[model samples]
Target: MDTLGALALATEPPTDNLMKRNPVGRREPLVTNIMWRNLFVQALYQVAILLIFDFDGVRILRLQNESRSNAEKVTNTFIFNTFVFCQWSICSSII
Candidate 1:
């Protein structure tokens, strides 16, 4: 067997430690998967609204205000806050 085959054959399985089992964090659905998935979806929705605003279009945040869905509002707020923090960090690093 070659080096690649040898490495594959030598790999050991993970231990049965449920407490330290979160290897992928939010990417894998062990814990906090529902929250992460919702946040991701909200981020995508926010991005779509921003894209609409980019080329001389109407702002969608106003329309969101007219809706009675608390979940949607919370998701939009989370996405917006996440973006702002990212922008702040990027700008701070450059300054």
Candidate 2:
């Protein structure tokens, strides 16, 4: 905890010693509270959940049924996220 505390303190204000110590500036926050505002009524909210369950999140989920022994396989969300990130990374690096 001391290390984190030191880093945080060091990064604060003119004391940006931590930022200098490791010169890469940390990423800024992407999402904010304003972006999370719900635009649905009570009726529409339930319908949205039903739609998600019926069609899935852009086919992001799958179920394995061959397991009589409780085995399962699942696509990790990070797998998709990383794929997208790498594509963007390569494209941006080319620039």
Candidate 3:
């Protein structure tokens, strides 16, 4: 080959060698999948919070009114109060 032809050949990357050495195709990154999973988990967490704050609160209040004994009423109130306190603490800590 001439000097210029030899120089060009030397500078050019060998496509055949590259293709043979790395046969695997490019793959999608894991970040998108991980982000979607995190969003799903967060949505489930919000649903759980709604169930606890709304449905459970209503049920507890109803039960409190139905109970005849003072002891049972006090126990139910205490449990509800504790739940509220814990929920508040969690919110405050997160903020």
Between 1 and 3, whose lDDT is larger?
3
**What is candidate 2's lDDT per residue for 1-95, written digit by digit as tens?**
24555576667677466456755446744544554443234336555554554455335443443342322223334345545564454345434
lDDT of 3: 0.61
Superposed model 1: Cα runs more than 4 Å off: 1-68
Q: Which ten residues in a row have the lowest lDDT in candidate 1?
A: 54-63
Clashing pairs in 3: none
Off by over 4 Å in 3: 1-31, 59-95
| TM-score, one value per model | 0.30, 0.22, 0.31
Q: What does candidate 1's lDDT look like per residue over 1-95, in tens digits?
A: 14544465467455679448755655555547786886687678767755555432223344444545664565567556756765565445434
Query: By TM-score, how accurate is candidate 1?
Result: 0.30
Q: Encode model 3's per-residue lDDT on 1-95: one tens digit a residue.
A: 14555576588877877768955556856468877896687667766765565546545555555545764555556566766765565455444
What's the candidate order when arranged by decreasing TM-score?
3, 1, 2
Model 1 scores a C-alpha lDDT of: 0.55
Top candidate, metric TM-score: 3
Q: What TM-score number comes out for model 3?
A: 0.31
Best-fitting candidate, scored by lDDT:
3
